[model samples]
Target: MKRIRASVIQPLLPDDDVAERHGWTSVEDPFDTELDHEKVFFNEYLTLAMRVDRWVVPGPLLKAHLREAEEKLLEKKSLERLGRKAKADLKVMVLKKLRRQLVPVTKSYDLVWNVNDGVAFFFSHSNKTHELVQELFERTFKLRLLVESPGTAADRRGLVAEEQRAFAALEATSLATMEVAS
Candidate 1:
């Protein structure tokens, strides 16, 4: 039986804007193997690196929630002085609980299966699996899959020209008002 392997190279954090700036690209290379070796390797190397580098919590939603929690706690303290120390302690406790619930933000996986053809399949571990896979695909391909075609080059050029004209007009107006009483 022919063997197929699926490997994914994803950023520890979903955003990873620095990676994009550094021209880091994710690519999946599938190869054919004769051995029927079902292997699963879970190395803590990547996770450790991510934790050290602070590349966790790549999504804005999670960050926003954290910020909201902090804001609420601050507001509550500012509004009332009754049992202020206790309130502060409770807030700390709540924050700690939320941190624990915050999922490990950086993770990637590789699945090597002994199968025929290049079709890669896997069981759904969670409802977020599909979304996560799609996110990985976008990062790996560096291509956004949109329903319709985006703006053309000419359109972009036109927009740039309009912006330049607006800027030039503003500059001229500002310069014209300079008083030169000599």
Candidate 2:
């Protein structure tokens, strides 16, 4: 059992097609590989997890390669004789080679969804992971994720009858004051 550090609840809009869909549907991974996408099911709590795989090269290793390439070019002639474009091209080539040697870095997060309330509880607090999850969720369900907090949940949740009328009747007023200390 993981403790949820932060949570976001989004109300599913009425008429969304997902309401009609049943059972778990796996979402395609946009990053890479042919591994089957994780499944998302309609249940008391729908648990979703996404694994992000990225090939990352070490900065120091990349820099060393670039420096070595530059030095070899210099040994061939004069460093001052090398054109800016030629130097840039060499650097780009070295970096590309270094990048090719990189191994994948995989990150995964488990998300629990409450279909009844249209709320999603992400197990992690990392904003990067959350953004990825939101994107994946929307793409998988063809629905939007509206972040819900205590202060904004009421307004975000669809207004009902009297609440809708009250919302429509409300007028906006600036809370800021023009008066300033001399």
Best by lDDT: 2
Q: Model 2 off-target regions past 4 Å? A: 1-42, 76-88, 156-182
Report the Cα lDDT for candidate 2: 0.56
Candidate 2 Cα deviation (angstroms), residue 155: 3.0
Give lDDT tens digits, candidate 2, residues 24-62. 112333232222223344457776556554445577887
* lDDT per residue as tens, model 1, 1-182: 11112222232333333322111111121121122322222232111000111233335755566566666866877853336575565545544454454533333233222223222343334445444544543454444422212344334455677766654465323444436743
lDDT of 2 at 109: 61
Q: Worst ten-residue run, lDDT, model 1?
A: 44-53
RMSD of each: 17.1, 12.1
Give all candidates' CA lDDT scores.
0.36, 0.56
Q: State the displacement of the C-alpha of residue 114, model 2, in Å, after optimal TM-score superposition.
A: 2.6
lDDT of 2 at 1: 15
